[model samples]
Target: MHAGTTVELLCRLETEPTPDGGRAVVVVEVSDHHPARAVRARQASSADETRGHGLQLVGAVAESWGITYRRDLKTVWFRLLAGPHDRVYGPPARFSQDDPDLQRDLRAAELLAPAPVRRSPARRSDADWINHGALSFLAEASDLLSGQLDEEQVALLAAQLVVPRLADWCAVWLYDGGSRDSSGAPPRLARVWHSSEGRIDALRMALEKDPPVLPVPGPQRDGAGAAVPWPWPQEPSGYGPGGAALACRLLAGGRDQGALLIGRAGLMRFPDEVVGLIEDLTRRVARAVATARAYRNQERISQVLQRRLLPRGPATVPGLESSVVYEPREGAWAGGDFWDLFDAGDGRWCFALGDVCGSGPEAAAVTGLARPVLRLLARDGYGVGEVLDRLNKTMAREATDSVAAVAAAVAAAGPGPDAAVELRAEAEQTRFLSLLYGEIVPHADGTAGARCTLASAGHPLPLVLGAGGGVRVAAAPQMLLGVVEDTSYESESFDLAPGETLLCVTDGVTERRCGHRLFDDDDGLAGHLTACTGLGATAVAEHIRRAVHAFAATPPDDDLALLVLQATERR
Candidate 1:
C-alpha cells in the first residue's frame, strides 16, 4: 500500500454511538489496484516485542470484530463495550459472514460509512489523490466561495465546489427567514446538483416520486458541528448505498443559513474527520450567502423609494426648453437635493430647486414634503418671496412638533444623566432648506422669448449664460428657507434671449471639493459654461455633469441636482 492508502483509510474512519461505548468502522474500497484478500496476523514470537502487538491490542480491547464487503467496498469494523460490560464479552473474534448477529451489525456499519466515489484509474502525483486530500479540498472550496455577492449564486457555487471533489452529489438548503439558525424555522432547499447530468436527472425524478428526508426528530443543538443523519438513499433506485445520506448545518456568525447534504453511490460512509471538514466549509459559505442577501435587499428597497421621491421626468414646457440631471451621493437611497417644474397658472410656469440639511431618509422626508408644498403655494399665485416666507414658517412649526415628540418619548422611558443633553440636541434639530424659486411667463411675441422672476433663499444665485458667452450671477443670495419665520426675501427679473440659458443647481455642484479648493470658486463651472455657450439646455446640463465628474478627485460627497432652462428660437 502507498502513503496515500493510509491517508485514505484514515479519511474513511467513522464512529457511531452504540448502546455501549461506540463502534468505529474503517472502510477500504476494493479497486483494480487492491483485490479481495484475507489477512492473518503473524503470532508474536518470544523475542518479538511490537511487530504483531498492534493486532493483539485491537483484539484484546474490542468486544467484537468483523470485516464485510458489499458492492465491491470492504469495511473493517470493531466494537468496544463501555466499562464492566467489556469484561463480560471477552476478546474479539475473527470475521464471519454467516453469523446472523454479526451480519446485521456489519450491514448497519456499511450504511454508516461515507458515500463511495468512483476513482479514475489514471495514476496521479502525491499532491493529487482525488477526494482523499481533505486539506486540498478545503482550499479549493475557499477559493470557489470568494467574491460571490448573490445568495443564489453562492449556493450554486457551493454545490459545484463539492462535486467530483468531495461527494458525487450535493444539495445546499438555506434558511429563508431573518433568524440565524434552524432553531426557529426549517431550512428551504436552495440548490442541488450531481457530478453527472444523468445522476442529477435521476435524483430529481426520485425526489419527485418520494417525500424528502425532513429534519430528523432529536434535541436541536445550537452549535453541534457534525453531519446529521438524513434518511435519504445515496442513489436513486437500485444504485449506491441504500437510504444512507449525511447532512451538516451551515452556520456563520450567530445565524444558521441552512444545511448541506452530501451523497454518493455505494456503501461508502463519511468519517468524523470528513464531516468536520464539511462543517467548516459550510461556515464560510453561510457568511458569504448572508452578506449577498443583505446587499440585494437594501439595493431593491433604495431603488423603490428613490423612484417615488424623484419626478417622473422634467415636466413639459412650451417655447421654453428645460432639462434636469440628478445624481445621489454614494451609500444613500435618496439625497437632500430636489427639483421640479410644474404649471402655475395660465401662461405661467413654476420651477424650483432646493437642498435639505442632510442626506438619507430624514432629508428625503423633508424633500418629499417641500416639493409639493412649493407647488401648491405657487399654484395658489403666491409670489416667489411670499412662497419662501411661508415655507420657512411651515418648516419651523414642523420642527417644533418633532422636538416635542422626541422629548416626550425620551421622558417616558425615564431620564438619565444624558437625558437633558439628548433633549437639547433634539430641540436643536431644526430642519432647513436652501431654495431658488422662480416663475417664468413667456412673451406674447411671435419670437421665442420669456420673462423670468426669481428669488434666492440661502441658495446659490442662478447663473445666466448669454448667447455671447458671458456668465453672470442673476440674483443676490438671500436667507435660506426653513430657518427664521419672519425673514424676508427679494425677487429679481431677467430676460432670456432667444439663445440664452439660465442654470439652477444645488450646492453639490458648487461645493465639489478637490483637495481644499471648491469647483465653482476655481472657475471650474464658469469655464465650462463659457465653452458651452451655444449648446441647448439638455446638452449644457449633460456637459456640466460630465465636467464635474471628471474634475472631482473622488466621487461627489453630496447629491448633485442641475436644472437648465433655455429660450428657444421660433420653429
Candidate 2:
C-alpha cells in the first residue's frame, strides 16, 4: 500500500455443490491481507489474478493499505491521505453531532486559532490579550465619563467594540432639538440612536410615525417617536444573535439632560462584567454634560452682568462725537474691562475705562466694585487724576493681591454755538488728568485742537490718527495710574485740522501679538489706524477692534477698551 493510503481487505474459502454448477461455503475460515489494494474488482479467477494495473495505481496513491481475516468472509477498505492541495475528509472520531457543547468548544477553538503572520506582533501572553482589551474598553469608557469624548468619539468606540466583536453593524443617533417640522415648527421625532445607518435614516424618514424615541423633555418625542427611558434598547429592532443594547439617561443637577445608547449584534447578551463597565462610563459622560451646562450658565450670567455694568450708549457732547467699545476676553473667564459714560451735567461728560489684571468671578467682582466707586468719584467732582489716585488706593486697600490699570478722561462742555472754541480753551487747562489722558476741543474759529496728557505708570502709549491720513505717536506719556500718589503728569496740545481724527485706547487695543512681534510696541496698530482714516468714530473703533483680533490670531489676552473721537468738517 502507498504511504498515505489506508486499506482493508477480506477473503473467503468455499466448497462447491454440483446442483447448478454453483459453489457453496462449508465451515470455511477466511483470512485477509494486502500490501496493495485494487481500486476496482472485475471478473477474474482469483484475487491474485485481479491485482493488475488497478492495484498498482492504488498502491502508488494510497499512504498505507491493510487487511484482516474473518471467520466466513473477508472485507477490504482503503483511505487516501490528503496532499498539499487536497482537502482532508470526514469528521474525527471524537466529534458528536448531537452535542452542542462540543460544537461550541470547537467553534471557539477555530475562532481563536493563530492567524497568518502579518504586520501585527504576536501576543506576548494570554494575560496581555485580556489586559489590552480591558484597558482599551476602560480608556474609552473613561473618556466618555469625563466628558472628554464627543459624539463622534462615542460612535467610534461603539463601532470598534461591538461591530466585529459581536459580528454585527451598529450606529448611534441623537435627538436634534433644533429640527423643525413641515409646519416650520419643532417636530416630535427627534430623539433616537441606532447601530445601523440605514435604520437611522428610515426612522428619520418616518418621523411622523410616532416611534419609540422621545425628546429629552417637554411633550415632544424624538425623531424615532420613542419615549426617553433608562436602559433603552441599543438595537432599534430587538432580534439577532450576540445582540444586546443598553441605554442610559444623561442627567445634570437632577434633570434629564440627554441619553447614551450602546449596542452589539448576535446572541451574546451583555455579561455583568461588560455591563458594569458601560454603566460606569455612562455616569462619567453624564457628569461631564452636567459640568458643561453649568459652565455655559455661568458664562451667560457673566456676559449679562458685564453688559449691565458697562455703557450701552455713546456719549453725546455738543462739540464732540465720541464712541467707546469694550470687548471681554474669550473662554470661560469673565473679564474686567469696564467703561462708563456718565452725564456730568451742564454740558459735561465723565468717561472712564479700566481693566483689572485678572479673570473669572474675582475679576468681575473688582469690576463691579470699581464701576460704582468711579461714578461716585465723578459725582464728587474728583478730577481724572484724583479719581485714579482714589481708585488705586481703593483697589490696593481692598484687594492687595490684585493688580489693575485705568485710562480716564473728564471734559466740561462749554455753552453756546461756539462751545467747541470754549471747550478747546478748557482742554488746554487740563493739567491734572495725567499724561495718558487726551482732550479734544474746538477753537473760537471752529478749528479743532487736541491735548495728549500721558502717564507711563508702565502703561502703553496712545496712537493718533490724523485727518490727512497722517499716523504718528501721541504726546510723550508719563507713569501709569495707581503707582504713586504724588506723581506729576504732563500734557501737550496740538492743532487738529478740518478732518483730523484722534484715537484714545487702552493697551489692550495695541498690545496684540503678531507672530513674534508685539503690536503695542510696534507700528502695526498705527498703520491700521492710518489705513482706516476718514471713518466715523464708531466705524474707526470697530475697524481697530477687528484688526487687533486678526493681528493676535485669536482673542486678546487682556480686556480691550477703545475710545474713538472724530472731528467732522462741520459740513
Candidate 3:
C-alpha cells in the first residue's frame, strides 16, 4: 500500500488487533530501522500467514519495526511518524546515527529560516532629507521680512521649500478684504502663481455653485488636483495636483491669516516631518504680516493725534498780528506747549502762552485741560491776575502734580483816548499772573500808547522789538504762577509806536541747542532774530520756528510756544 493509504488503515485499526488465535493486540514504538527490517520481521512471525496483510499495512505506516521476546510471550511493534494532529505522541527516542537523509533534511530546514526585520530604505532616506531641509528652510525664512516677501515671493518659497522637498505641488490662498462674490461675501481665492490655470478655473466654478462646498479632511484629489484644508475656514480654496496632500492654517495672534497647501504626486506623501516644516514656515509668515500691520496702525494713529493737538491758523487781532509755533519733545513723551487767543469781551482780546513741565500723554492731557480752562476764564472777563489765581486754584484742588508757567496779556482796542490811563490803573491792581499783562490804547490825537504790567513766576521774560529794529528784554521778572495766591504783580508803561513788534515765547526757544551748543545763551538765536527783524510778526515767528528746529536737529526736548504780535497803525 502507498504510505498515505497505509497511514489511513493504521489510523482505523489504532485500537484493534491482528486476526490471530491470540489476544487482539497493537504495539506502538519509535526507532530508526529501515523498511527491510519490517519485511524480515513479518517472515519470522509464527502468525505471519494469518496477519500478513495487517503486517504489510503496519510496515508501510511505521517509521521502524521490531519484536521483543519474553520468558512466556513475544511482542511485535511498529513505529509511526507523528502527523500534524498527533500531539499525544512525543518525538522519536532514537534514530540511526548513520542515516544521511535524515540529517540532510534537518539541516535544510535550519538553512531556510526567516531574516530579522529592519527599516525600509525609502523611510530612512526621506527622514534624513526632511531634517536637513527643515533646518535650512527655517534659517532662510527667518530672515525674510513682510516688506521683503510679497505675495508672489511667499508662493514661490512655498513651492520650492515644500513641493519639491515633499515631492508634491504646492499652493497658497489668501482671503480678500474687499470685493465680495455673488453671495455678498468677500472674495477669497488661491493666490496667483501658486495655482495652475485649470485648477484656478475649477475653483472659480466651485465658488459659483450654490452653498459652496467646504474643505473636508482626507485626500481630496480629483486626478492630479487636490484641495487641502486650510485653518482659515473663510478663506477660499487652494488647489494643487497630486495623490496625497496636506493643508496647514496660517495664524497670527489667534487670527486666521491664510492657508498653505502641499501636494504629493506619489505614494510617498507628506509624513509628520513634512507637515511640521510647513507649519513652522506658515507661522513665521503670519508673524511677519502681523508685525507690519501693527506698525502701520500705530503710525497712522500718532499722526492724527499730533495734527489734532497742534495749532492750525494764526491768531488775528485788530492792532496785533500774532503768529505761534509749537514743537514737541522727542522720546516717548508728547510735548505740552499750548497757546491761544480768546475774545475777553468789551472790545478786548486775551492771549496766553504756557508750557506744562513734563512730556508724554500725561503732560498732553494736562495741556488739553489747560487750553479750554484759560479760554473760559478769559471769556468770563477775568483780568490777567484773576485768571492765574483761578488756574492755580483748579490745579491745587485737582491735586495735579503737573506744574506750568503761563504769561497772559489783555488789551482793550476800542476805548477812548484816556484808555492808556484806565489800563495803567487796572494793571496796578492785577497781581496774580506770573505774567506780563499789556494793554494798547489810544492817546491824545488817537496815537496809541502801550502799558505793560508784568509779573513772573520762574518763567522767561518777554522780548520787545521796536519799530526801527531796537531790541530790549523785559527789565523786570517775577515769580511763577500757582506758587502764591496773594502775590502782587507790578505795572510798567511803554510807548507803542506804529509797526512795533512784541515777542513772547516759552523756555523751549531759549533752552534749545545746536548740536551741543546753546542757541540763546551764546547769542546765536538773538543774532538770528535781530538779522531777521525786517520780517512781520508772522514771518518772524516762522523764522524762529525754523531756527529752533534746525538748532535741536530733532524734535524739541520740551514744548516750545512762540507768540509774535506786531502793531499795525491806520495809515
Best by TM-score: 1
* lDDT of each candidate versus the true structure: 0.67, 0.48, 0.50
Query: Which numbered prediction scores highest in lDDT against the true structure?
Result: 1
Model 2: weakest 10-residue lDDT segment is 406-415
Error of 3 at 147 (Å): 9.7
True-vs-predicted CA distance for residue 552, candidate 3, Å: 6.2
Q: What does the lDDT come to for candidate 2?
A: 0.48
Local accuracy of candidate 3 as per-residue lDDT tens digits, 1-571: 2121221122222433336622323446322222112232223334213332433344334433433322322234554433434456766667697877666533321332221121122133556766645575576556533433244444444444443345434555554431111124422444422222224444444433422233323333311122244222122443433356566654554444455555554443556676666667777765554454444333343354355555566445556667777666554434556666645565656666666555443345455566667678767876665666666665444314322211111111111112232223322222222333443333436455333433344556677777677777753676555456565545445655566777777788888866767768856555666766668887998888888888855677666778777776644
Q: How close is each model in CA RMSD to the real structure?
A: 17.8, 26.6, 34.6
RMSD of 1: 17.8
- Candidate 2: residue 37 lDDT (0-100): 33
